[model samples]
Each structure stands twice: as C-alpha cells, then as structure tokens.
Target: MYNSDTTSWQEVLAAFKRIWGYDDFRPPQGEIIRSLLEKHDALIVMPTGGGKSICFQLPALLQNGLTLVISPLVALMENQVQELRDRKLPAALLHSELPTWERKKNLQNLEKLRLLYLSPETLLSAPVWEKLCQPQLEINGLILDEAHCLVQWGETFRPAYRRLGAVRPALLKSKPAGTKIAIAAFTATADPKARATIQKVLQLQKPAAFQISPYRQNLHLKVQTIWTPRGRRQGMLKFIQARPHEAGLVYVRTRRDSEELTELLRQKGYATAAYHAGLSPEERRQIEASWLGGKMPFVVCTCAFGMGINKPDVRWVIHYHSPLLLSEYVQEVGRAGRDGKPAEALTLVSEATGWLNPEDKQRREFFAGKMRSQYQEAQAIASKLPTQGEVATVAKQFRDGAIALSLLHSAGQLEWQSPFHYIRHQSGKSCSFGELNAQQQQFQTQMTQYLTTRECRWQFLLQAFGFAKEAAGWRCGHCDNCN
Candidate 1:
C-alpha cells in the first residue's frame, strides 16, 4: 500500500498530470483525495461538473489495491470504465448486462484491476460477493458514485443500497487481520437529510464531507404552467424551435410520454429519438452513442437518459413534465451548460384547476399514498421475518419485500449481513412509518411549491436543498422570475 502520510504532494500532482493532464487540482479535489489516501471515509456533494470523479479516480490510481466503485447505472459504469481503459488505465466493470464471455474475462482479470465499477445490485449478487470476500483479494477503498440514489431509491426502487451498511464489517471478517478499506461517496445533489441517510446507510464513520453550493449562474431556470395537453405540447415545440439545431434533451416522466413526444417532434422535422429503460441495452446504447456523437440533435427521454453523460455544449434542457422531486429537477437541469457557457432549463407544469389538468395532482397523490402504503407494509412484515435470512428468501413471501427489508434496516429494526442477507436486530420494534410519511409529504410539497413560486428559481432550489444561508440575499438575474 502507498503510505499516504509519507507520500509528497509533488507525486500526487505528477500522477494527476500523467493521468488526466490537469495542471492543478480543483478547489476541494486535492483535500478530498488526500482524505481517501489517508484512509478516511468521505462524502462529497459537489454540483454537477465540479470535478467529483477526479477526487476518487485520482486517488484510486495512486493507491495499491483495487478501488470498488458502486454506481447506480450500468451506462455510467460502462462509460467510466471505457474512458479509463482508453487511457490505458486498469479499469473493469461487472454487471448483469455483460455477455457470458466478457463477464468471465473481467472476473479472471480482477487481480490486475486498479479500479472496478459495479452497480449495487451486481456487487451484492452471490457470485460477485463471494469473489470479493476471498482472502487473497485486497480492496483499497469502496466508492459510492451518485450516492444520493441511496437516499432517493433505497426504500423503494433499489433496496440493495440500504444493506450496504453491513458490507464493510462482513468483508472485514474474511480479509487478513488489520486490513483496512476506506469508503467514499460522491454525488451532485444531496441535501442535509440525504447526506445523513448516505452516512447511515453506508456506515460512514465521521466522514470528511465536502459540499459546494448548487447555484449555477450560467443556467437559467424557468417554469411554465400549461392548462392543456395541447398547450404543453405547443409550448415544448416553441421552446425547441427557439433553440433550432443546438444539442439538448427533453425529459418526460414516462416511456409513453417519451414515445409520444418523439413522434410529435419527428413529425415537426426534428432529428430526435426516444430513450427509456424499456428499450434493450443495445438500443439504449445506440441512442446514447448517436446523441453523444452528434448524429442526433436531441433526445426525448425519461429520467434514465443522463446520469454520467458529460456533454458540455448541451444548450438547453426542457422538462415536458415537472419532476416529482426537487433533487431530480436540480440534477436533470444541471446537465446543461457544463462547459460554463450560458444555458437554459424550462419545466412545464400543469395548471392547477378542475377542468384542464387533473392528472398532475392525481399523480402526486397516488405516489404519496403509495409511499405511505409501503411504510405500513414494511412495519407489518417486520415481525414475521426471521432473525437472519437471505433477502431473496424473504422477498418470495411478499410483494416488494426487498423494500420492506430496506425500510426495516433504515429504521434500525434490522441489520444487513450482506446486500442479499439481513439479521433482525430488534423484533416487534415500531419503524418510523409516520415520520417517513411526513418527510415524503414535505418533499412532495416542496416540489409543488417550487413550480408555483414567483421568486428566483435558483434561490428557491438552494433553499429547498437546505442552503438557506446561501439563498439569503442572493438572486440570479438569469432566471425567469428574476428577469
């Protein structure tokens, strides 16, 4: 292992230049890297384009053993791994999408790997977990990329992340004595509550946290409330027409919306395609490649479109429908103007009234009720679950049972043995169903308020994400409200 205490900053700088060709480190990149090299866990909450990747990537290269990056998306993992491989760095990824031969090859080459990326789901799978637990393997660090997903999706969409808190201890049991592996989580948008959730979920110990303000002066924020479906479509068309051939992305809430809007734009002579999770991996990759290579001018997509995509010249982003959460809104819009040039983001919301748009309120209420039911269901099942059992075993007995286990883990009623297994820590303990429900309602209300606010959009976002001090006495003249 590299003795970070004895290593000089000159060596670090040299490695940085050799790998990334950057003459100097960004503001907190150096500090964040040092924290990891010294084996201190960290949580980084820099805005998009703030050079978050380098903080972990650079240190991984400088370290001896492998760095395991737990990312949420397969595309994101493949993108980063491919970039590293292109640079002749030792990087590989493991995911279910890989062909049989490719998966075998990656597993065989694990010992030669410097950085390995995998989704939380894949990392927790039996095959991968067994390989990682082998005593001969040495892991330098674990990185949770796009860490806010742990907070956003842990309870519902992906429960494997909730069990990650147990990973360190379980892995330690198999490793040689005194083997220490540091952990670091990186994200573009995590408020105070989300940060706390990440720390608890990942078992980060007194982690050195680095958070930058989410404000971007170059990205103008705007919201328009359309009273009818036709009006919304027309408004979107007008917005797209105003931009012409510039590269941009149109975000919709569902696959149906993506398909419908793509056809509408195609009929209007726009070079575009629809992208959603419903497409096969090859199809998604083709669309992504075409968009990235400039063959396609724009894409009408669901939220699955742009996580780790580094398109600097994207001039605009339009939300055909308002996102359910402010975090989603901030992340989706932050994709534009990454090159620090002027860009625009506009969200089309439904006008709140009986006749024109009942779907918006109905959707919000449906989601809120779904969340409440999930919490209630989790509480009900907590008593019936075994003290120690595999996740798959318990999941077979109930619908969305993985989510139930995750909620119990979060509320301290259970503990994970690994991603796929858990141990009941406290039987018959009441999980904080009411508290979680209230928090969910608050988050929904905040998004609704953001759509209706007449104040500076950026200011509203900063305040919403727990940056009250920064939002105070500040106004960006670029936003619609400020203008």
Candidate 2:
C-alpha cells in the first residue's frame, strides 16, 4: 500500500495527470482519496458534480488488486466501465445485459483488472457467487454505489440487498488469509438512519462515515402550492418561462406526467424530452443523452432519472409534484448545482393526492401481495428439505427460511418468536393498523413540513432526518426561502 501521508499532494497530482491528465483534485476529493488509501471504511455522500467517481476510481488505480463496486443500475455500471476502459484503466462490469460469452470473459479477466462493477442483484445469485469465489478471484475492496438504496428508500423490501450481509461473510470465508478488504459506501442521499442501514447491510467494520452537507449555495429551493391539477400546469409553465435556454430537470410523479409535461414544455417553445421507467431502456437512454449533451434544454422525468447522473450545469430542478419521503426530496434537488454554480429547485405542490396515482399505489400493493405469496411457497419448500447431505440440506433449508423471514419481517406482517422463528400476522401487526402505518404517517408529516414550512429547505431536511444543524441555522444560502 502507498504511504498515503508520506506521499505529498504533488505526487498524487502527477500520478493523476500521468493517467487521466488531471492537474488537481476537486474540493473534498483529496480528503476522501486519502482516507481510502489509509484503509479506512468511508461513507461518502457526494452530490452529482462533487467528483465522486474520481474519489474511488483514483484509489482503485493506486491499489494493487480489484475493487468490487456494487452498483444498482445497469446503465450506470456500463457507463463507468466504458469510461475507465477509455482511460486505459483495467475495468469490467457483470450485469444482466451482457451476453453469455462477454460475461464469462469478463469473469475470466477479473484477476487482471483493477476494478469490477456488479449489480447487487447479480451478486446475490448463487451460481454467480459460486464462480466468483473460486480460488482465482479475490476482491481487495468493495464499493456500494447508490449506497442509500440499501436502506428502505430505494428498497422497500429489496430481497437481493438484504442477502448481501450473508454474501459478505461468505466472500470473506473464501478469500485467502491475510487478505484485508476495504469497503466504501457512496451515495448522493443518506440521512442518519439510511447511513446506518448502509453500514449494517454492507457489514462494514467500524466504518468512517463522511457526509458532505447536501446544501448547495448555488441552488435555490422553492415550493409553491397549487389547489388543482390545472393550476400545476400553469405553475410549471411560469417556472420554465422564468429561465429560458438554461438546462433544467422537471420531475413528475408518474410516467404519464412526464409525457404530458414534455409535450407541454415543447409547445411553450422550450426544447424538451420525457423520461421514465415505463419507457423502453433505449428510449430512456436516448432522452437522458439528449438532456446531458445539451441537445435538450429541459427534461421532464420521474425520480429514476437522477441516480449516478453526471450531467453538470443543470440550471434548475423542478418537482411538479410532491415526493413520498424527505430523503427522496433531498436526492432529486441535489441533482442541480452540482457544477458548483447557482441553480434552482422549484417544487409545485398540490393538495396531497392521498397516494392516489393508480400506478404508484398499485405497484406497492402488487409487490406486497407477491411477497406474501412467495413467503408461503418458500415456507412449504423449507419444511420439505431433507436432513441429509450438509450442502444440499443447508442451502435448501437455510435460504428458504431466511427469505421467508426477511420478506415477512420487512413487510411488517410477521412477529419474531426468536431469530430463527416467526409467527403470522396479528391484528396490530398487519398492514391495516400496524407499524407500517405509523412509519408512513411519520414520513408523511415530514413531507408536509418540507412543502409547507417557511424555514430553509436545507435546515428543514437536516432536522427531519435527525441530522445536527449548524449554529448559523441555514448552512447554505441558495435555497428559495433563504433568498
């Protein structure tokens, strides 16, 4: 390992310039890179243009073996891998989009590479884990990208992520003795609880958590209340007209909202595009590229558009509707002002829909029902596992039991009898009148304050998430209420 402190900032600069030809580090980048080199577990909360990638990528280059990056988005992994390879850095990604031959070849090349990115979903697969654990491939470090998702915001019951704790132990068991693996978890949004969850879920050992304030002095946050849907359209138009030709993002609550707003903005003479999960992958990428490349001055999108997005110089970010949670609100707005220049965040809030968007509401219901059914099926399967061979019995019984328990526990439909045992839904524990409702109501109250309060949005958010606020009250000055 390089003696990080003994290595002057000049040596780091020369090495970076020699490889990527950069003369200096972005603000905070040097501190983070130094932390990584010193073998400390770091929790990095860097906004879009805070130079997050270089913080990790540079360390990967300086390190001896492969750095395993656990990314959630397929496109994100592909983009990073391509960029690294372009820089002549040895990098590869294992994702579902890869063909069989390519995936196998990438796995074979793991020993020769400096970085390997894999989605948590792919890493959770038993077959993939088996192959990766074979004597040849030993990970030197682990990076969890979009690390906040390991908590409930991105994963309400993401089974794959829950399994990662066990996977880490399994990985450690297979690696050679004296192998010291460093893990760093990075995200754009993580409140105190989410940060804790990320550390626990990733099984980090006394991780050093570093959080840059989400407040950007360059971005203004505004919330305007509209009484009707028709009023929202007029509000959006007015907001867009206020600043023409500057790049911006408009976030809507639904896919249909994205399509309609895109058309509305175009009719108003602004170059625009719509993006959401409902669109085909190709279509989404095209829209994203258009917006990022400055071909379109604005993009009407769902919350899915901003994760790991590197587009800088976004002049504004407008939320056409309210988000369900405060964490999400922080993430969407953080996308702007990432270039360290002034930007704006305008949220057009209407009277709450009571969560009535058919698609959003139905998807939650559908997933809940599916989890219940899967739980029952897995329970039956586990009961039938024979007490015979160690590997087969343990795999069949332990996995099924773990899955059944985690799903039910997360869904709030089961009460723990012991660590290994659980009982069925009691009245208070069921969905109708349970802990779930209590938590949902609490978050709703937080959202209400977010939209209605006269206080600075940054201060409001920090308090809502149980973070310590600065003594000056508002840390950053560019938010709507501050201005």
The best candidate in terms of TM-score: 1
After superposing all C-alphas onto the true structure, candidate 2 shows an RMSD in angstroms of 5.5
Candidate 1 Cα misplacement greater than 4 A, ranges:
417-420, 425-430
What are the lDDT figures for the candidates, one per model? 0.87, 0.71
Q: What is the lDDT of residue 89 in candidate 1?
A: 94
What value does the lDDT take at residue 235 in candidate 1?
96
Candidate 2 residue pairs in backbone clash? 221-480
- CA lDDT, candidate 1, residue 448: 88
Query: Residue 43 deviation, candidate 1, in Å?
Result: 0.6
Could you tell me every candidate's TM-score relative to the true structure?
0.96, 0.82
